[model samples]
Target: MWYQVFLWALFSSMFVHIIAALIAFCRLRKHKIGAAVAGLYRAADFEMMPFYALVWGVGQSIIVSFVSFTRILATL
Candidate 1:
């Protein structure tokens, strides 16, 4: 059960990260920010942002999953 919760949280975080990145990219492009401003806001390369976000999100989800599993265990 803990493993399942962890896996679910990891995948959900990845999915959410992808969607958020896409939306952010679209908004950034739509506004036509200057190259310098874009560079300042997004220091990392465009191709790497999504991967970075996914990794960060997954890390956060791991903590969340652990906490949730502990809570469930405590209730029983």
Candidate 2:
């Protein structure tokens, strides 16, 4: 059960990160040189990445746990 929770968190965080990167990349590609330079700086903005990942991971994990708990209760 704990392993399942861990995996859920891991996958959720990874998915969020991948989607964010793709979105950032797309935005960067769509812009002019100045915007592209700014985008490069944004892409290298590591300060918020970990916080975002942690928030998403924990949020997903909480949702998963709540759903599983309710399912267990229903089975009882």
Candidate 3:
């Protein structure tokens, strides 16, 4: 039971991160932020330790995604 719960949580987090990364990339492309920054952000996301990623990464990713969402809505 405990193992199942852990696996579920892990799966959910991975899904969230994948979505967040997609949003971040879309935002970057829309703004033309340059390949260097885009590459750096990608590197950072991958290099981030799992523990810290689980704790703080979600918040950061969500914030970026939220800002992108609002910006898109604002233009319309």
Candidate 4:
């Protein structure tokens, strides 16, 4: 279950990141010089995706645990 949660969080964050990148790229592409500059920065940005995924997954796990604990408490 924890593994599944981790995968879900990772994939969801990645999906969101990709969509955001596409939007930013499209907007930046209007100017050749700007796009080139953004492309350079985006390379470094992409490299941090795994770190983003890890943080997102851990946050999600914490929320899930909190909710589960609350439910158990309510039942008692």
Candidate number with greatest lDDT: 4
How do all the candidates rank in terms of TM-score, highest first?
A: 1, 3, 4, 2
State which candidate has the highest TM-score.
Answer: 1
Backbone clashes for every candidate come to: 0, 0, 0, 0
Q: Which wins on TM-score, candidate 3 or candidate 4?
A: 3
Give TM-scores for every candidate, taking all chains together and pairing residue i with residue i.
0.44, 0.41, 0.42, 0.41
What does the lDDT come to for candidate 4? 0.87
Model 3 clash count equals 0
The segments of candidate 3 whose C-alpha lies over 4 angstroms from its true place after superposition are 32-76
- Put down candidate 3 lDDT per residue, 1-73, tens digits, no spaces: 9999999999999999999999988877767557776588798886766887687878898988998978976
| Candidates by lDDT, descending order | 4, 2, 3, 1
Task: Please give the lDDT score for candidate 2.
Answer: 0.86
Which regions of candidate 4 fall more than 4 Å away from where they truly are? Answer: 31-76
lDDT of 2 at 2: 100
**lDDT, candidate 4, at 62:** 97
Against the reference, the lDDT scores of all candidates come to 0.83, 0.86, 0.84, 0.87
Better of 1 and 2 by TM-score: 1
Residue 7 error, candidate 3, Å:
0.4
Measured by C-alpha RMSD in angstroms, how accurate is candidate 1?
10.6
lDDT (10s digit) by residue, model 1, range 1-76: 9999999999999999999999988777667556566676678655557889899799999989998978966777
